[model samples]
Target: MLAKTPFIPDKPILIVCGHFGSGKTCVSVALALALKKSGKNVTLVDLDIVNPYFRAADAAELMKANGINCINPEFANTNVDIPSLGAEIHSVFVNAERDPDSVTILDVGGDSGAAALGRYRQMIERAGYNMLFVASKYRPLTDTASAALENLREIEYYSRLRCTHVVNNSNIGDETTQTYVENALDFGRELSELSGLPEAFTSVVKADFCPALAEKYPDKSFFFIDNTTRKLF
Candidate 1:
């Protein structure tokens, strides 16, 4: 543990953005728990406006139970597709600038989610942040490194923020097997190299897989977050 650097960053703000179906929301929730458990003041913002599907906000109860500050849109729990922005959404940025020891994670919807972030571009720029693009090889539009780079460019252009890292959250929910996890790390590493961005880590939902992961990819880091909610969408 002395030599192992944890997946959580020391930075105050982290933006998790990716193409639709890349599982950025799962990574966001997992990341919030990881940072909070590491002893940092942590807040999670559900800024995913495009996907009406269940998102980070859906894990509010679970997050709150674990002591993570969860900020969700007004209509996050409703059937409405209209994107709602609450003033509280800016609190994370405020904390980002004021609280150096705090960590804030923003789980964006998709490329469009990053586009919605355009409304807060000035604040985001002022607060300072590190954006991590989550990619999954099995997901459409990012199956290949070239395609992943293309998606990255599109999101960066819309958000006006460059990606600082990549997170390989390549999982097919409970169906994700060890073989898939192993393959994803390799694919994610390739994506990382092509994007000229470092991969923060690959995630596994089961803690039992850690030993096998360590044995197979001795050079990589990982996060084990068991999804606590059942998907309704």
Candidate 2:
């Protein structure tokens, strides 16, 4: 069972953004699945026009099986680079606004992919949202605290929105170890301080690793994740 954490916001709109390979898509998929399992009417929007590979659309079958409504851009999973999205995307916002039990998860593309979200800024803001900026020290160009901060600002600028929380998602895929997760604690803290946003939680891929980490860092929260985005390959 996926444990629910504070990272799942009370707001109807939850936007997940991060540097490439920071695992934002995986986080988004996992969150959507968890919400569905918890009896919420969940909708996942793949707003990743920038990165053609590893999109939430790739997991459409799994999402459907789990009772999650998924919306992807029109040209997703093809060689075409057209960035057009479906008109149905509007219904997600409309439905969420009227339905309190509904939650929409936006798995934004990495880096400049957040720009795709700019056009929907007004609707998202009106419905209230919690934008989570995920940071991973293992990914290139965002390995340092300063670099991560710069990337966060770029996403915010492109989206025309501010991040309400920071999530430390540092990991090396299956190579992730407890030591790697522990090392990211400092990076997470630095990012929280620099951004002036609360550290929503640290996402740990290894479920068994959570108890020890939680005991050590009682002030911090950890979310256990299963790697659902890997099937995109």
In lDDT terms, which candidate is top? Answer: 2
What is the lDDT of every predicted structure here?
A: 0.81, 0.89
Output the TM-score of candidate 2: 0.95
Q: Please, what are the lDDT tens digits per residue for candidate 2 over residues 1-233?
A: 57774455789999999997899988898888877877789999999888876788988998999889999999998999898989999998898778999999999988888998899999999999999999999987999889999999999999999999999999998889999999989999999998999998899988888889989989988888888766534
Residue 133 in candidate 2 has what lDDT? 95
lDDT of 1: 0.81
For model 2, what is the alpha-carbon lDDT of residue 162? Answer: 92
Clashing pairs in 1: none
Runs of candidate 2 with Cα error greater than 4 angstroms are 231-233
Tens digits of lDDT, candidate 1, 1-233: 11122476746778889998787877787777777777888898888888886688888888899899988888987878879879998788878878787888888879767887788888877777789998888887788888988999999999888899988877787888898888777788888899999988887766767778878778888777666545655
